[model samples]
Structures are given as C-alpha cells and as structure tokens.
Target: MSATALPAGHALRRPVLDDLPEVYRLLVAHDVSVLGFPDLTEDDLRDEFTEPGFDPVTDGWLALDADGVAVGYAWACRKGTSADVDIDFYVHPDADPGLGGCLLTVVERRAGEIGRELGHGRIRAMVGCYRVALGEAALLAERGYTVVTTFHRMRVTLDGDLADLADLADLAGPPVPSGVTVRVCGTDEDLLRAAHGVKEVAFRGHFGTVPQSFDEWYGHFAKRSSTDWSQVWYAEFDDEPAAMLLATNAFVETDNAGYVQALGVHPRARGKGLAKLLLRISFAEMSRRGRTSAMLGVDTNNASGALSLYESVGMRPVLEIDVWRKAITLG
Candidate 1:
C-alpha cells in the first residue's frame, strides 16, 4: 500500500524490528490491566520471531505512521475454524483509531489470500478491549465488530508479608479423589502429546473451537512458546489425562512474572479439585522461580465459573475485557 493520512498527524504502514521496543512499551502501558504478558523484552521480541517453530509471516505484522514511524501492529493466527477462525490484534493508542478498520480490511484480504493458499473457508477474528482502554474500545466499536464474549485478567500476589499458603489449607478442601496423580512434564513428546489429548477434550466447547491437529499443537505450543517445562504442571486420574497447566516465564524488562497460558480440566475431571490443585502447584512453582506474582485469564461467562474459582484461590480479577467479533460469513 502507498502512504495515506488520517484526520490529524497519523498514517498506517508496515513495521520493522526497530518498532520492537515501542510495541513492547505500548503493550505494557495498555495490556496489563486486561491481558497478561505485562512485561516484555527485546529478547522476547526477537524470540517471538525466532522461536523454534513460529511462522512469523503467518503470526506477525508491522504498522507505521504518516512520517514512516512504526506506530503499531496487528497480529494473530488461525486459533481454530470449522469454516471460521479467531484472530487477535494489537493497536497503538497514539495511532489513528480509524486505522483499526483499515487494518481489519487488511486482515481480511491477507487472511483470504492465506486461506486460499492453504485451502480453507472464511476466517473468524476475535478482538477485545477493556473499557478502561477507551482507544481500543472505540477502535473495535467503529470497525463493525460486535461484542461476542468477555474475560478477566486474574492475578495472585506472592507477597512475603502475606499469610502463608498453609493458612489456606482449608481452601485445599479435597485431594484428587484418590487414585489421581498430578506431576510435572519433561521434554518427552509422547507424554506431551498425552497432555494435549486432555487439552483437546477440555477445550471442546471453548469459545472458539477450531480443529487443531496434534502437529499444529506441538509445532506452536512447545516450539513457539518460551516454555520452561520445568514450570508446567499436569494431572491424571486412573492413568487418563485429567487436567493440565502450561506456564511460561515473562521475558519482560521488569517484574518477575509467571503466566499460565492454558489451564483446563477434562469434562470427566470436573469437581475433583484437579484445577485448584494444579493451580496451587503452579503457584508453588512460580514462588520457587522467584516470581513475585502470577497471572492468567478466564472467560467471564465460563461454564465452570472459573473466575470465581480463581478468586477463591486469591487470584483476583484485576481487569475485564469484552471480545468483539464479526462472523466471516459475510462473503
């Protein structure tokens, strides 16, 4: 595309590596409240592009301003699709709010090309904005996207001055109902594959359920992520996959934070206290890693009342966000 102008001193173009620090800054100043990844580092930025199995072309973008300034970028992947997929975007506050729509147009055009190349149907996108983030909220609202879902950014502070976990033993109410076991995983692919099976079941009726192959899961999950398997937790009962928690450390410039990107319990595992046990296990692991806090997100209307569960474990909702969506059936 050629150069174009917005209402004021604004324009939109592609981004480059120099935009890394700025992107990180924008995400930090805005994302922490409703999303995780509170901190980011140049290494993190570089890793995002170089992480073993990440396909940068399919997952990233560069946005520039009128003066050729790298303003912001919108990026996401095919989260899932049975004819529709969910994509995520990150826009800058100082950039033209109007750019959101233009970018969505860009996304549709680009994704269509991608889908055709790979052979697929319509592309579904999921975008969200915290009410506190007026720019983001306005951008999505103006883009012809409608609110479809909501989630909360939950956090648990590991304060040295705080009461001990032992004091919360009552909160630990029940064990894994006997014959159930939970443990950490190593670099074993088969075992990882097993854990993923549990994930498949756990995410069956999730907000966006796109058919994801195990190859896709392994390619993206283990390879693209900055995972420390030493930090991941998994649970099983009667030798069947029951629950799992996969966490990664934040590569941010500040704040020693650990993030549990995916946490779920198999439908059959519900009410067994596996989720909370795995959560406490995650909390203990984070403390061992010297992290002062840990965070995760839960859909506000989660069928399982997950937000309430997190709160019961001292992970309070620090922010709320609404997911806006436009079905791709328009074509």
Candidate 2:
C-alpha cells in the first residue's frame, strides 16, 4: 500500500544522442515478429536521432532507470504522404515503469508538436512491426492507442495440391514477348540491383506509400535478408525486366516452420500467374527441404486478392488480429 517513487521501475524522459546504441540493442534483443526489416548496426545508431529528415533532438526521447540506463524510447514526427506515425519508438527489456511513463510523455509531447506544425488536430505514432513486444504496444494501448489496421503474419502448407504451383515448373515464357525475358534469378549483385529496381516500381503506389531509399531498401530488406538467390525469380517479357518473386527461409528454432518471406510481382506485369508460378517453386522447394509449411504476410484489403490467392494455395488464416490505433490530440 506504499506509493512508488518516480523514475523507479520504468520511467520515461528525453534522451540524448548517446542513448541511440542502447535503443538499437533493445530492438535487437526482444523483437519476435515475423522476420522483416534489417537490424540496425551500431554505427547506424549514432545517426538514428538525426538521420536525414529525422532529428531525435526534438523528435525523440528515452526511458531510463535511476541508474540512467535506457529501457525504452519513443520519437514522433509530422505525418506526410506515407501516412506514418511520425511518432516511432520502443523500450528495452526490464524497462523501468517510471522511466517508461516518462518516455510515453515524450511521445505525447512530440505528437503535439507535429500536430501544431502540420496545423492538424490529430497525430499518429507508428510502431514498426508489433510482435510479441509488450512495453511499447501495451504502453500505447493503455494511452488510448489501438491497433488501426493489421498486416497478417500468415502461413500455408506445401503438402496438399502442388498442382497450382507445379504447372509453372516448365513454364516456357513466350519467346521474348517483344523485349522481356523471364528466368530464375541469381543471388549476384546485378540481380540484387534488378530486384531493387522492380521493388521500387511495384511498391511505389502500394499501401503505406512511403518511398524507401535504395540504402533503406537494401539494408532493411533485400540485403539484410537471408535471401536464397537460387529460389528468387525474375520475369522479363521481350528480354525486359518486369517482375520478381523473392523467397527466403528463416530457420527458426521451432520444429518445422519455414517462411515464404516475400511474394511480390511488379504492377506492370499483373494477370500472368507469375506469382502463383513462383510460389509453386518456393512451396515445392520448401517441401523438399524437410520443412512442412511456409508462411507469408498479406494485406487483407490488398487489391490483388492476395488473401484469396493464399487461401487457394492451402494457406488459410489461422488467426486474425488488428493494428488498433487512437489518434493523438494536441488540443
């Protein structure tokens, strides 16, 4: 029945640039979401606070213990074309409650600043990939932030109906449909560059319209992934690049769970079953490797009927979850 002291268990407060390393370490330590995004390097931590258009001095804060060790951090910025949270942040393990509370205060403070600057009434705090992490998600949910939408961490089995994907095994694309050529891709530098190019084109207008820089794209996804270039494929019509399906396996410590990471096909080359074709390859290949199932995430509202396609392939939704969010108010 005793009152707890401030800055005791997990408190929040403004953070200096020096705390970047601790934040990065915290992210690496407890993230358990479906594998996405690159792990930030130690050197990258230094510029995290002020990277390009993001400056932590005014937009960031950290949660620290009485000993001044960082447990959690949060930062916010103005919303733009991407419809981002502007408020992005996280906390480390065994974070102090007092310190965590202070960090949330900073999140609110920055949210207000963004609202004022943008002349808007509401602000959003975007958390990247809400996995099993509690300190941040629980904190936000407690402060009236509910999950807004959800991106599925879905999976499907490879044993049943290999026909949908098997047909493409011998797919002999038309002889150079003018200037395009389709072939299984290699993990070489050139293919990586091509993969980057196609991704830029395909995702440019997709959901979360945030355009990623080449470095961000490479480091966060392509380069950072344990991508199996042998399994990657590219479609070229008339010998000109058009689409790709990038697949990789992240052998988690569990029994027999494999992941079908990315199943992207460029916009210009839609309607051709290229995705189904590539998925078949990945499925058959995964089955060959002693793995029983493959998993991939798809936007439920995707215009591409991605959910349907996945279901058609024996990949059903085992669970449904939402990304709830409550707008931050400056008034």
Best by TM-score: 1
How much does candidate 1 score in TM-score?
A: 0.80
Query: Who wins the lDDT comparison?
Result: 1
Model 2 agreement with the true structure over 116-209: per-residue lDDT tens digits: 7767666665554454445556766777777756677677654555456544233232123445455666746677677667777776665555
Q: Compute the lDDT for candidate 2.
A: 0.60
lDDT comparing candidate 1 with the true structure: 0.66
TM-score for every candidate vs. truth? Answer: 0.80, 0.62
Worst 10 residues of 1 by lDDT: 167-176
- Per-residue C-alpha lDDT of model 1 across residues 228-270, encoded as one tens digit per residue: 7776667888887899888877532356767888888998879
Report the Cα RMSD per candidate.
4.2, 6.5
Model 1: runs farther than 4 Å from truth? 1-39, 47-61, 80-82, 86-97, 114-122, 160-177, 251-253
